[model samples]
Target chain A: MEKPVVDQAEALRKRAASRRRRRILLYVAAVLAAFYSFWPVMVMGLEGYNIDLGVIIAGEAFKTTTLYIGGLPVNVKAIIPTAYYYLQDLGLEAYPRLVANTLIVAGLSIGLSLAVGIPVAYVLARIEVRGRSLISYLLLALRTMSQFVVIVPLYIAYSRLGLYDTFTGIALAEQLIILAVVVWMLRGFFSDIPRDIYEAATVFGKNEWQVFRRVVFPMVIPGVVVTTMFALVLLWNEFLIADTLTGVATRTAMVGVWEGMSINQLSFNALAWDSLNAAGFLAYIPAIVVVLLIRRYLARGFSLGAAR
Target chain B: MGAETRQGRRARESRRWYLLFIPLFVVVGFVEIYPLIESLYISLTNLNGGASLSNYVTMVTTPTFWNALNISLLYSLSSTILAVLIGIGLTFILTQELKGKGIFEAIYILPLAAAPIVVGVLYSPSSVWDDIQQFFHFILHQPYFNELTPSFYFPVMFFSDAWEWSPLIMLVALSIVNSASKEVYEAAELHGASALQKFRMVTLPAVFRSPVMQFVVVLRFIDAMRAFEVPLAWTNWLGYTNTLGSPVDTISLYLYKLLYSSSLGFPLGVVSAVAVSLFVVTLVGALVLLRLMKAVGG
Candidate 1:
């Protein structure tokens, strides 16, 4: 008995030591991976700040001094108002409109996706229809089709249909990508709802539509919200379709940034750098805000889709 | 008579449910399918709008198409492989017992939320490229490491894509790992399985068994095959050396150049042919991926 007890204690201690070592190893690996992944963003953020403040920390021009604020030594530096310079280069009047246009395009695209996607997802989830798998495959194909491939014909079609450069046209073009994702994600959510709830509602003399409206729809509100958020993020970050389809009237902030870079390249204009970085910063802000706000939902949404 | 009527009503109701699909089908058909058909038709015709096999013949014969195709394959294969490895590794590490795992996981996935364009700009010659060059030069202490070359572009593009997409794979892996039955793991442990054995037997198989994992793998493959924004932005910054046989011009970028470049001025027929070819390639690639996954019991 004594020998068995001693052996058990020894095994327990060994297990505890191994577990501790594994935990330490995991933490170290996670931190390193996180750093590798986020280093680029950090570099970009720092670059943006340096440009916006007209301070080159890497250069000898950067100066630091200790300031006595609230009886504490605080690091302070001379900073130029590069924001004003950026604004001047960007043409203060054009900047707000550019931001507004990006917002409008993102908003309209999300709206269009939701309006068309929910009903279709409902059918895909609830109704046992013939050729459901075929529809799913079609949606997947649409999702996989390179925007470049579709944009070619769509460009010609848009120009012919008088839809080019219009908000509605751009929004519709954005829908090509957003719709597939919305439908697929929403379908996942809708299917996750317990079938017994829908059956119970139907047995109470509710029509299929009524059951959808009263029982299924409410249950998937969280899903809709998350899906919409995901779609919004995708649209807001969208550059390809918006770049190809939109003209002067409907150019988004992303396009503005791209054009700024192009102008700098083509003309070797120095001021364009300031404007480009500023525009890049502006374009990134909403996505950052959205990610921060909906981080949990975004994680849940991605995992949920994968779970299906 | 009553039973027949009930069956008929049930049939009618199910049929009406399909009516819900009509609006979606119309929009997709009008926006997606119709254009695709029109494009395919254009691909099969000559400049004079007459039916011709010239475009297809040219696409097959042209070295430029093959070069672009090769570049695209390289980009997609390298990026997808690296991303999946990193993603799976991160998933395994993250699932281990660690403090502040949530924070680490959140930060790891931040790139997913970022726009590809933004990621492109961030990694382009303007921002992190300089830092990367400097870091590399310092490590190697070689003059050759200082300049960004065609070889450098591959890794840059690969890292940018992997950064943005690895999180997606991680998400899928995590969900699969988390949802795995604890009993199964315990059973493996009870069998006196080593850590490596447990992982190989229980964890890896379980994760791969999920259909969602298979879907993600296939989707990532397809997406990588069509990589556009990052490479485009990178090349744009690097000054558009997207000539017919250029090293870094991906298939989509090549197609974009064909359509947009004033000097090239490719005819619509040829452009459409290339587009159709790209679509077919994606489809075939997807099918192959699915088959591979199935073969692996994933």
Candidate 2:
């Protein structure tokens, strides 16, 4: 008996060492690969910082043949040189409006999503619903369908309903992709909490709404923020829907980049390259800000398949 | 405490909880199921390109669907394996007591956050990656990089995407790896066990079945394969933009054009069918891969 126990201990000990070494190696590999992936944007960012930003913006303006940013040539060209162009650029209809447009869409999408997600999540977390497994997995299945696959039908459907080219259209479309995911992630987090917490709420005379607002909401706040970040980035960066559902009037940053590239009329100078990079670099800011703000949410589970 | 009152109270509780599902049911029914059903109706009908799915059926039955589907499968499998292998590698690296670990993690996760289309635009196959492509071209003595031909294009794309998403896989794996017990390692060392043997016997058995952890890693690259934006955009960035806007295009891109077309040539019926098929595959792939990864370790 002692020999068998000793042998088991020895075998377990050996395995632990190998696992630690392997884990160490894995982290090193991740760090290096991460540096490699980020190198391009770093280069783009540095290029914009060292050179004339206005010229860069100007270069993109005239450079891409397909970029139909403005009907007026002067309007496109003159806006690049202002001293406060980055923030001021937003107001020019071409830049700031698009930024604001993206924000508005992101805000509305997050709002609409939470309105539905919280209740669904609350039930999944707290209630003993029938068909729970079926419901949970079905939502996952619906969400697993890539956004591109469904964009066309939704676009055509929305267009038919005259909701095409609108924020509501895209927000509704996004629900198809991320809403279920948010619920799934939050449900996992919510489920882990002891039911006795809710029982205690009941003993304290808290109604469902009061319990949710006071007890559940604060505990899940981190998850919600992270979920919102995921939702924001998903809607902000989604391409198929943007390309099909909305036109230039409501072009998101991605559309701006796509429309620019498709037009491709660069003047072969550093300025054009810089502006192109600037726009591309600026395009990443919303994603960066959202993730950084809710870095905790991004740090864990909601992103396993998509958020990562 | 009577049976009748108890049953009635249980019924009342359920009704309240069930009401919460109203929003879920409505959203799922409209946004997800409706379009899916509508797409099924389109796939079977004959309403595209001056003909019905006769035109559509011919196209669906053509060698193209099989070919693209094969490419998608290849892309997904290849990327998934790459992400997993690379993810595990990075997890090993992350376990080291290295400086700047936080920065490294941030760098690794950036791609997961950025939209694929934007990646496509940045890495645009049309004219994107020319700088890096030119380097590889010089090394291999291939002239294809200069003109950005199809033969030279796909390799560059594969390199760019793998580079983009592989870090994410590692982050997922590392999260699991990080949570592992340290005392287990000290015990193994005290017994004088070897490093490779320790991992083989202990670490693999423990974390391998972690579904939330593994799914988070593998699910990403599988999703990457269905991607229309990133590969197409990067190829175009190299200057042959709009090359993929074709009937024989990616299933998603194909559906995209059909929906947005000015000519109304699309079979809405066929598009819906494709969407349904898309939903099924996404679900199945996630399930299958989840099972496969566990089997690989278990």
Candidate 3:
């Protein structure tokens, strides 16, 4: 009996210890995963900031200058430049042109998408159209088709039409992605409006256009905002289309930065790491800020179409 | 007579509503359908513009094309599987009672906002790659840390893609998991089911059985299969030219090479053939995935 009791106690202790061990393992795994996720961003931010700071405080180094802070020697020598200096270093003509082009392309793409997408979404949502499911499936397939697949033909067509190396060309290519997403998202939003609301509007003798313009459109404003924000971010980060479609004249910021980096790579010693990082940082900030500013909408928007 | 007129007017109104679809159809048709048709047509012709099936035959016979297809399959399948697994694991841990989970969630998603080129730059030898290398070499004392090897190339590419995309999967999985009814779990507990048993019987099916989950999977797979930017940036940064049989030469990149940098001059016809073929493959794959998911879910 004593031997059996001892054996039982040992078993219980081992089980408890193993349970504790498992919990520790779980905690460790979580922390490690989080670290892995976050460290890249942290590194990029740090490198980018360091470079930007160095550029901003460009000044002659006072050789042999040192300062003591709590028994630690610190070099108080290197001086950074002003924002103007850094901007000049970032290529005043080219950088500004790239920025303008990026903005224009993104703006035009968004405008065109909204113009095209809103009406289609309304029709799909409110009107009882034949082969509605077929249309939706077609849109899904188009969305799934990689941009690269279409890009080949697009390049040839753009070149043929003299749309190559132009802002409109890039915008048109970007619209391929933007329009589909907008239509899909807005359809979901529009469909969510209770059928009774449409019936009530029709009962009030409101025409189809008026019902859409006055009633359905107003109700889907939140969805519109969410879709717009997401679309803007996507358009801003687009590289493949921009890289292919645009030449020197219409090169967007993404393409410009890439080319600049590659050019800099050839002369590694004289490479403007600061300028490169600054450009990268500049490129990255808008999307991050936009996303964070409208994070709530994004969270809701992401869950809206699919989850429903 | 008044009710008949109202019904006629409603019919007219619905017909007019169809007009609203015209602009969208025109735009999409011009951009998507036209290009697709143009690609198909181009693929069926020779460089001399003569109609022929020679382009498709050439693509089939080309070793580079086969190599690219193999690499694409390897990269997409491996990356998708790993990312989904990691995403599932992260979702499981995240859904548990943990402190500061929100911060982790936010951090996990930060990569999604970054451009692929930016990601490549961050991981390239000129930047944090060296730091990562040193961490392995000096800290871990594992010398001979060569990142140029195929082993390094595959994993780095996989990790980079996964880093950007896994968060999306996590979000989707979490949404599904959280939305699962608590009553099921309570019932399982009442039945004296163990934690693992309850999770297997309840949580797994709850998350995986959703149609939305399958949609997300197919979408991610398509994206993975066509991955270009990250690999391009990495190889560009390293000045590494991807030849035939190169591990990193995804089909899209291979197509790009043919279009822009082919030694036999611009093989537009062959590239177009490859594009059309890939498009068909992706569509069929997506359909098959949908069917499989439906079968499993049911």
Q: Across the candidates, what are chain A's individual TM-scores? A: 0.78, 0.71, 0.74
Docking quality level of the chain pair in candidate 1: acceptable
**Model 3 vs. true fold: TM:** 0.85
Pairs clashing in candidate 3? A56-A80, A56-A81, A57-A79, A57-A80, A57-A81, A58-A80, A58-A81, A59-A79
lDDT per residue (tens digit) for residues A1-308 in model 3 = 69999999999999899878867877887888888886766655544433222222222233335544235676644332324324543566787788888888888888888888898888877767776656665666666677756888888899899999887778888877777778877877888899999999999999777998899899999888888888888877877888889987888888888777767655673325656766776777788777776554443344325643
Candidate 1 structure quality by residue, lDDT tens digits, B1-298: 9999999998988888777777788778867888888889989999887899998998888888898898888888888888888888888777666678888887887788777777776777766666555544555564535334877777888988988889878877887787777998889889998666777788788877777677677767788777677777666656664455556778988887887775786678888899888998776755654454344332
For candidate 2, write residues B82-115 as lDDT tens digits: 6566666666555555678777766666766666
Docking class of 3: acceptable
Q: Which ranges of candidate 1 are over 4 A from the true structure?
A: A1-22, A51-91, A265-275, A292-308, B136-146, B188-201, B285-298
Model 3 C-alpha lDDT per residue in residues B139-258, reported as the tens digit of each score: 577764777777777788888888877877788777777777889988988999765677668877887887767767766777778767767665664564434445577887776666
What TM-score would each prediction reach against the true structure?
A: 0.87, 0.79, 0.85
Question: For residue B216, what is the lDDT in candidate 1?
Answer: 70
- Please name the candidate that would achieve the greatest DockQ relative to the true structure: 1
lDDT by residue (A1-308, candidate 1, tens digit) is 69999999999999999978877776788889998877777665544444321234234234665534335676756333334434553576777787789778878877877888898888877766788757766766777787766787888899999999999989888877788888867987887888899889989999777898888999999888878878877787777788889999988877777777666655655434545666676666677677766665554454325453
Question: In candidate 1, residue B82 scores what lDDT?
Answer: 82
TM-score (0 to 1) of chain B, per candidate?
0.88, 0.74, 0.87
| Candidate 3 Cα outliers beyond 4 Å, as residue runs | A1-28, A50-93, A265-270, A294-304, B1-11, B189-201, B237-245, B262-266, B286-298
**Candidate 1: residue A133 lDDT (0-100):** 59
Query: What fraction of the native alpha-carbon contacts across the interface, defined at 8 angstroms, is recovered by model 1?
Result: 0.52
Q: DockQ scores for all the models shown?
A: 0.48, 0.36, 0.41
